[model samples]
Target: MNRKRCLILGASGGIGEAVVHRVIEDGYAAAVQYFTNEDKIRTIQQGIPEDQWAGSFQADLSTKEGLQAFFRVLPPEWDAVVFAGGHMYSGLFQDMKEEDMDALYYVHVKSLWMTARHVLPYMIQQKQGNIAVVSSIFGTEGASMEVAYSSVKGAQNTFVKGLAQELAPSHIRVNAVAPGLIQTKMNGHLTLEDLQALENDIPMGRAGTPEEVADAVGFLLSRSSRYVTGQILHVNGGWC
Candidate 1:
């Protein structure tokens, strides 16, 4: 298998970390992206050999400057791009402030668009590339308290589907992985009882691990799934 260079956005997050490792294990070099988590990024650098590490770039996906700064540091081309950086805010939609809503949109939706804008031209030139976004089960089956988060995730899913078709002619495949209930820092707000209640809703009686979702992303990025495009592969274990 040919080793491709992959740039993983949000490499400091829970799912991002796993995807980074999985991509590396698949024989690809990684360019890890981060916001403020320098420690984690450093850890990743330490684990991967210097030759296989394309280096990490810091950028706040929620800010225009951050986006531009990251793009400025990014290489002109990559073989694979994975968007795994996003945050979820739980609250009644009516109670959500304009700032919170805007943050969600910029972080989840805008960042993806902007990052792709910078990278797609490079991919187009190559005529072959892969893209993956980490979506949520809530994107399809909306959540009550997480209305804003759900909204943006929904947009991400649609973005993957639409962009996949538009880029397919160039042999640039795009897909998404929608994870149900993953044990990550994103769920740290939940109380034990709340967590138990949420777990009860899953048919599997448990939540998914980051590695499991990473496994799905790894498959989608591989030649084995080259025929697949514009699909939302659910890693929810029959939850939704």
Candidate 2:
């Protein structure tokens, strides 16, 4: 049997990197997508066997034309699509600038919607596909000092829910993983004290690992989750 092709956006980030490992371990031909961080991308590529590595592309997903160009370079068929790319800006709502809002909208909301719009038609035509979106707990409950980030994530949560229903008839499954407080470069600015304080709040008493979150994603993409759709899986270590 031919191995399925899987596309992972933001493959250079912590969670994205973890997803790439999991996908490759599952025997899929994987493609990593990124807009920047060529060094990290190169490192990830080196870790995978050449036969399983489908190469990388740099595309700024903030524009429609950019997304079109990104997709134009790929093969017409993909068995799975993972929207793992996102951006977060934490600050007082009053301190938020227009550009901040635009950045959040472009990365967290618009890009996912537009990519899904472009990809789903092909999935529908093929009559089989899976889409897993990575969201944050803020998307469900909102977050202080993270107004723009929370809003975009909330939109992503709703998008997954609605898209799951809309695509189910075509034999396409859509789900999301909402992770909380993972130790990624994204949180490098936090002090040890800050990290511990956040961890204490979670019933699990520790920050979730990217690999743990990736495991949730793997489950959603597998046959075990064949009957599941329109659901948001929280990999937050018991945190709300």
Candidate 3:
């Protein structure tokens, strides 16, 4: 039998990379999506066994054209779609530029909706599918200095809930993994003092590892979560 096909967006990021490993281990033939990180894409490809590596796609998901171009090359029969593509912006709300907010909206919200819409027909035809987004803990309980990021992530959370309900009847599961504080490049800017202060607040007293979050994503995308849908699973180390 052919292996289940899984499309992993933003597969070059820390969490995305871990997710790739998890999906392969869970028996899915995986394809990856990246933006401009060809070097990282090559690195990710090297890690996966050739037989299980589906393909790699590059697209700027912050624009409709990019998404269209991406799907043009992406096959239509994916069993799962994991949206792990996005960036974080931190600064005072007042200091934010309109363009930055637009990019966030496009990347974190618009592209996801469009990607789902594009895949909906195929999933409905097959009558089974999985959609999981990598969201953030700040999305659940708002965070300061991350107003735009939080807003878009909150939108992502709501999108998952609404889309899950709509797709559940069709046997298409939609959910999100809301990770608390993963040690990824997104937080590479944090100083030692900043890191310590943040870690002190978490009940676990440490940041989550990308693999931990990937474990959650893998579950939601597998038969293990057959009865689950429209849920935001938090991997926050009991911080919230």
Ranking of all predicted structures according to lDDT, beginning with the best and ending with the worst = 3, 1, 2
TM-score of 2: 0.96
> Per-residue CA lDDT of candidate 1, range 1-240, in tens?
356899999999999999999998999989988888999999888889766898888888887777778778788688999999988888888999998888888899998998888888989999999999999999999999999898898999999999999999999999999999999999999999999998999999999999999999999999999899999999997897
Model 2 misplacement above 4 A: none
- For 1-240, candidate 2 gives per-residue lDDT tens digits of 578889999898999999999999998889988988999999999999888987787888766677778768766567898988877897799998987788789888888887777677778899999999999999998989998898899999999999899889998999999999997888888899999999999999999889998899999999999999999999998988
lDDT of 3 by residue, 47-112 (tens): 888888999888998876887887797777788999998998999999999889988999999989
Once fitted onto the true fold, the runs of candidate 1 whose alpha carbons sit more than 4 angstroms away are: none
188: Cα error in model 1, Å: 0.8
Question: TM-score of each candidate?
Answer: 0.97, 0.96, 0.97
Worst 10 residues of 3 by lDDT: 62-71
Against the true structure, what is every candidate's RMSD? 1.3, 1.3, 1.0
